[model samples]
Target: MRLSDKVVIVTGAGSGMGRAIAELFAKEGAKVVASDISEERINEVSTSIKEAGGEALGILANVAKESDVQQLIDRTVQAYGTVDILVNNAGIMDNFIPVGEVTHEHWERVLGVNLNGPMYASRAVLKIMLEKGKGVIINNASVGGLFGARGGAAYVASKHALIGLTKNTAAVYGSKGIRTNAIAPGGVNTAISGTITAPNQLGMEAIGRAGSAPMGEAQEIAYAALFLASDESSFVNGVVLTADGGWTAH
Candidate 1:
């Protein structure tokens, strides 16, 4: 149990990669706070963890809301007394609309959940982490963050900004005992794709290229996240670990 008794908060823990991360962490002896926007899903995940003899608390939260994010951290402290790991994994996908076709409303909404959500969560958690003089923040970025064409304008921009945030946080807090890193996942079999609208010409081309690459399992990403969250990655900071299956190699 590498995470033995560590307090971990995983956003979007209701399903997909987030669910995998939470379950794996609990199995590894972490007290996990499983958060998601869906009450039903969150409860299901928490119940499963408890049935498996693990400690877990499920909270319904819209990470894009600062107030909700604050309540999340406050509740975690109330239950666990401290925050050890924060996994900013809750995110949404935008229809693969090109920059020229992306609307302002869509852009704001996408950035709100994918970018501002993580920022809010990180800010709320950093206060407690800084006081403890040690903490780990693992953000779920995308290959779109590393390269264009993987996502629409808003999605790509948000992830790229997220990577910047990860690096900056690590640089500022590494000396203070906080480690921040990101995981850039390529194509994973997840529910996020269900939100995609019709693809544009550029998006279609990217999709074609993606079709040749192998899709990774949610557990594969959870495993990478687990390593980054555990003490095994104590010396690793400000890194964007690409969990994609050679999607970027081309």
Candidate 2:
């Protein structure tokens, strides 16, 4: 139980990497506040955690909204009294359109959720963390942050902006005992709304395109997150740790 007795807030905890991260943290003994836009999914996650004899509170929150973000932090504080770890995992992808083909609405929505959402959620906890004299913020960036794919202009833009924000926070807050970092993960089998067809096909493609490096499991990223949250990475700050399956190694 690396996180035993500590409080954690995980956004987008209803599914995918967020859910896996939340469950892992709770298993390691953290009191987790799991929030998602959907109340049903949020409660389902909470219930599963509780069934596993872990502590969790389900919250319905839209990470892109300032009010909702604030409420997320507030509710966590009220439930577990203080937040020690925050996983900014709530983000939406662009509809895989070229920049010329993308609508303004699509771009704005993607940025709002993927880039601004992390900013708002991190800001919400900054004061509390500053007051407590220590905290960890983990922003879930993507390979999109580092490379421009064929039709991920909006995703690329948003992630690049998020990297900037991550660096800024780490630089500004490291001295105050706050460690801010980001993870750029490669393809993982998650519920990303219908593009991913075959599961093993993804792994096969990853192995080939990424040159034999396997596409990571959500648990792998969760392990990295656990390390970052622990005192193990106390000296580490403002780092963008890439967990891509050697995608950018070339």
Candidate 3:
């Protein structure tokens, strides 16, 4: 058990990549706190974890809200005493549009979820981790963060900022036995569709409808997160691990 006796908090656990990561982490013998905006969705994931003989708690919270982020950390501490891992997985994508045509509402919503939410969650967890003097933080960045115009203005900006946050936090906490890293996932198959309206979000599919790159399952990204969270990555910090199926390479 790579994570035996570990306590992990995973946001956006209601569906998609977050769900897969939470399930995998639990199977590795960690006590997991699975959180999402929808109580039903998060509870479903929690139930599955418990049925598999793993300990888990379900939480419903909007990550963008400070109160919710604080409660999430408080609830986890109450349940497990200490947090060994924090996965900043909660995020939202705006209807992709050129910045020239993007509305302020869309920009705020996108940043609020994808950037501000993670920032708040990180701040809340950092205090706990610093006291413990040991922990890991993984951000769900994107391949879009690496290059130009992979997504609309807001999506790309949010991801870029996430990467920056990962690096900054990692640097700040490295001396305190903390490791912070990010996974820049390419394309993965999940059920969180219908939120994106950008015609050519992936770019590869945009030019001649080339179709999206060879995509991996969300479990693949989970594995990347797992490595960073586990002691195996003790020497690693402030790094962005790319899990995109050759999307960034091309």
Candidate 4:
């Protein structure tokens, strides 16, 4: 019951890390808002949580859209009265396309979901959180945010920017009772890899040079996120908690 009565919004909650985080939060007594672009997936997660005797609401949302983000927050407040935590977990991967060959469409799409989505959600939630004088924001960043060769150009750039945004938000709102942090996961077992249908040779070669690291489970990252969302991490803020099993150590 670490998060008893707390209202948490988790984006990309249909599957993988997001779904794990959403379910875990609910188990800890949080009223979870599971948001995703896919209605079917959202319903599945939400239903599972409810079946477990936890509170949950499934919201269909495409985080890339500003209007969607606004509506998400508005609906959460309407349902739960206020927001306590926001997890920006929705993201897409670039198909290992280096900058030289990356298309404008692909770049924009990746950045839109990975970066702009978090920005919009954070901006919208600040009003409620500021008034409450306490809030937590956790961004699901990646090792790509810390290193270059982990992903394609756009994906790397977006995650890097997300970490930056996390720090900046913490700095600006820390004293006002807001804690913002990020999780830089290495290789997690998620459907996001399915997006890489057409891999770029150079990009793949660059990653191959780094060698392979042990793949992590979605629940491991979810546990890390759970720590961030709970009071255990009250003193932590603006930190990029790397949960990659030391993949970047070497």
TM-score of each: 0.97, 0.91, 0.94, 0.99
User: What is the C-alpha RMSD, rounded to one decimal, of candidate 3?
Assistant: 2.1
Which candidate number would show the highest lDDT if scored against the true structure? 4
Question: In model 4, which runs have C-alpha deviations exceeding 4 angstroms?
Answer: none
Q: Of the candidates numbered 1 and 3, which has the greater lDDT value?
A: 1
Candidate 3 off by > 4 Å: 198-211
Candidates ranked by TM-score: 4, 1, 3, 2
- Write candidate 3's Cα lDDT for 161-190 as tens digits: 999999999888899998999998877887
Q: lDDT by residue for model 4 over 1-250, one digit each (tens)? A: 8999999999999999999999999999999999999999999999999999999999999999999999999999999999999999999999889999999999999999999999999999999999989999999999999999999999999999999999999999999999999999999999888878888999999999887978999999999999999999999999999999888998
* Model 1 C-alpha lDDT per residue in residues 50-164, reported as the tens digit of each score: 9999999998899888899999999999999999999999988887777888899999998988989999988988899989899999999999899877788899999999999
> Model 4 scores what on Cα lDDT?
0.96
Tell me the whole-model lDDT of each prediction, alpha carbons only. 0.92, 0.84, 0.86, 0.96
Give the per-residue lDDT of model 2 (tens digit) for 1-250.
6899989999999998899999999999999999999899899999999999999999899987889999988888888789899999887765555566667987888888899899998998999999999999999998778766612567779998898999999999999989999998877677754432332333333335434334678888888888888888889999889997776787
The positional error of residue 61 in candidate 1, measured at the CA in angstroms, is 0.6
Local lDDT at 189 for model 4 = 95
Residue 133 alpha-carbon offset, candidate 2, angstroms:
0.9
Model 1 C-alpha RMSD to native: 1.2
Displacement of residue 45 (Cα, Å) in model 4 is: 0.1
The pairs that clash in candidate 1 are: none
Q: Candidate 3 — worst ten consecutive residues by lDDT sum? A: 202-211
TM-score winner among the candidates?
A: 4
* lDDT of residue 168 for candidate 1: 97
lDDT score for residue 244 of model 4: 93
